[model samples]
Target: MTDTHSDDVRPVQPLQPEQLGTYFALMEAVSLLQHQVEQQLRAEGDISYVQFQLLARLAHGPGPLTMTDLADGVVYSRSGLTYQAGLLEKAGLITRGPAPDDDRATLVTLTGAGRALVARVLPGHVEVSRRLLFDPLTDDDVRHLGDIMTRVRDHMRARPPRSAAPRKRQRS
Candidate 1:
């Protein structure tokens, strides 16, 4: 006979010591680097890092993307996306329109001005990124890091998020 407690919920096990160390080191490095990037974006581009990411995403997309599609590509909530889109629209950087194919969906497009803003921000942005992310690593380290990151990202994304967890405001 099976033990009565077997079916009871079992807490997830903690990561092994080495795994914990690696996990935290990665998080710390990413957090520190992101902080520097945010400062650079604010000082040079006069935009928040998230705003820069938003503009870059719209600019790179084949065309206007539906809000749902855009949200899937970046880390943001549906309501939060609407607010950010409104800010860009107010700044004349992007335009939001009802999706032609899907009346229920909204589409976002990057304007010429938006394109220009992204272009202007790229030089400084790339410099800062290289300084923090790429400059310290050797060629082999770059390749290895790319592979590791790609694998990790793919593995994590393969699992759908649980209940679309809400996060606190990520930006001002």
Candidate 2:
């Protein structure tokens, strides 16, 4: 452990048992929720969670966005996103084309098929989401959980992994 004030290294202290238990419980909850959602998506839509996410992003956004923008927005690696895009294209769910002004950038957009898929799958998706997320929590619990997660996500966004000390954010 490094002293927060002085930066002196010391032996790291483990979390108290209760703290560890709570942490593990939170992780378990997240894993279970994700698994349930994934199962529902696969069963109902024949789409992996990642693919569904990509389609959902395109369907929800205002307009077609660049590949880089999609990659960043979806928190996916460039290569992985390229492969997923190919699958989507093959399925006639989305189209990839060159950006009109920027020859280097590829833009992605949903086709009529993709929009129809979203419209088709959304009811089951919402049902599963509500069953796993909202059904177990009170209104106040949901609000507090949302607030806490938002703060946690923002803090993580500001601080990159310690393995890669953050560089300055780049503009598109």
Candidate 3:
């Protein structure tokens, strides 16, 4: 019998030496920065990075947002987000309820405690970020990095995650 899947195979280009170096450097830098930020957040608020993200996003929003919204914003799974939201609710940091407009969606709201925690930890968060990620960069470098990151983020987000199939327009 002859193989029939030849058409499915496509040649792909490999990364150049410089491209590989850049990729490794980016990964290492991000990992190191995240580790430091995580340590700071855990030390200050006893919350994981994801938990802080959820709370911080909620705190910044105008009103209660759905779990879907939080999941998309934090780039986390819906189930994982649910678990995190549960932990926050138990801690008296947030509240979860049915969205008035959508019965299938669970809305997450930051409580007073949650807002206070963000305010408490934000100073350390900023300090850690500046020290670890920004201290070596000039203003121009920072601006260029912001532009590059935004473009990269948009490119990645253009393809909706498998978990979020059938994408909706991302919030501005």
Candidate 4:
């Protein structure tokens, strides 16, 4: 009889070299761009990437948002966003007020200083983004990349969560 634990001893299927190459290229490109932007923001302005993103989001927001709403807007985890919010609050870049409807939740708003900072940094940020991301790509390439990325994102989102059981192998 087969041992019950045999189910756990599955052979590993390696990704094809091309698939691995694509994954690495995408990751490296994103990492390098993020590092470059982070350095620029730090050197030109005294702000961490998360802090910059938080301020930028708030500046563009239609109205004040709770910490949870801000976290969702920026796709950050709630705990990390809260910590960043604290830093911004300490810097006088943002203000937290008791939510009118909900005493428990605080509404975060960009202060005048925060808005000014975003206005000051936005030109440089746009130039950097254009230089690093857009200038190199042809208009067609930009369109194609956007379309492909959207499709990939949607496809991934549509997939069901992975089961706890090991994935079954496809038969030839």
Candidate 5:
């Protein structure tokens, strides 16, 4: 306790070059893996991964979904989803129609061609998914990783807003 003032302070250490290199290497690995997967899908099915994802979502959705709903389901921003949907529509894989309840909103539906394409690709997709993610992990590891990811997603969703909630005055 004699001279604690200066002694208590610690110098900040900068990240080492190796640590930075590792981060870059990890990012490169993920990018390369995604590219490989995309190549495989394109070669086998003649469909891009994003297109496949849209088809899959449309196939699984309850009937026709609005453009906004499709965007939400695919986790794409509205504009991006719209662009992709337009591409799919041009490809004759999906169709767009006016929403039943809202004339302004458009509903997206999977065409027969889209359903057939998904059917053709699903087996390969499942195999790839299994090989990439599940085959290497033990059941407990997979369960734990899924749980952790879900927690992270939920935490992100539950972050408090900067603005305060509105309150109503009580009468005595």
Candidate 6:
């Protein structure tokens, strides 16, 4: 491991057993939870998890979101978001157009169908989440978990991921 204070190559220390166990547990739990959530979304709304995220964010936003905004919010690649937006637009669930204020930006907005889809799938989503994630935790445990995750997320977001950056043009 390289020391944070100095740039020197050093031996990496292995994680403690407890730390390793906790890391594995976190990964497994997230994987399982995401799988179930994806299944629920697919069954109910015929949408992928990312697509649902896109729609849900649009539904909750005060107004339209630019494609870049959506990419940052969803932590998805700009190309992938554009493709998904195209699919959603074709389905009449969403509409994408040039931003009124910025011609270079594409704004995404949920249509009635998108809103209705969110409304339709939300109950199952909530039920699945509550049953799988919250049922076993006490109120205090839930609060503590939320606090911990919020801190971790904020720390990670401090350095935005590569996907959050604007894409560069390719030479043709």
Best candidate per lDDT, number?
A: 6
Q: For this target, which candidate reaches the highest TM-score against the unseen true structure?
A: 3
Residue 20 error, candidate 4, Å: 1.6
- lDDT for model 5: 0.78
lDDT of 2 by residue, 18-67 (tens): 87888888999889887988898888888888888899999999888888
User: What are the per-residue Cα lDDT tens digits for candidate 6 across 70-96?
Assistant: 888899887888899999999999998
Local accuracy of candidate 1 as per-residue lDDT tens digits, 1-172: 1123457765556688888889888999999888998898888777887788789998887878887777767767778778888898999999999888889888899999999999988898899889989999999999999999999988887876422556667786
- lDDT-wise, the better of 2 and 5 is 2
The reply for model 2, stretches above 4 Å from the true place, is 1-13, 16-19, 159-172
lDDT digits (tens) for residues 56-79 of candidate 4: 988997878888677655667766
The predicted structure with the larger lDDT, 1 or 6, is 6
Greater-TM-score candidate between 5 and 6: 6
Q: What TM-score would every model get versus the actual structure?
A: 0.86, 0.80, 0.88, 0.77, 0.71, 0.88
Comparing 1 with 2 on lDDT, the higher-scoring candidate is: 2
Return whichever of 1 and 3 wins on TM-score.
3
Model 4, residue pairs in steric clash:
none
TM-score of 2: 0.80
The alpha-carbon lDDT assigned to residue 67 of candidate 2 equals: 83
Which tens-of-lDDT digit does each residue in 1-172 have in candidate 3? 1233567655556677888889899999999999999999999999999999999888888778988888888898877888889999999999999899999888888999999999999999999999988999999999999999999999998997645676477899
Using TM-score as the yardstick, the better of models 2 and 6 is 6
Q: lDDT score of model 6? A: 0.91
* Candidate 5 per-residue lDDT over residues 1-172, each given as its tens digit: 1123466665546557886787687579668666766777798889888888888888876778888766655566666878888889999999999988999899899999999988888888877777876787899999997998799767764753312223356898
Clashing pairs in 6: none
Better of 2 and 4 by TM-score: 2
Model 3 misplacement above 4 A = 1-8, 161-163, 166-172
Candidate 1 residue pairs in backbone clash: none
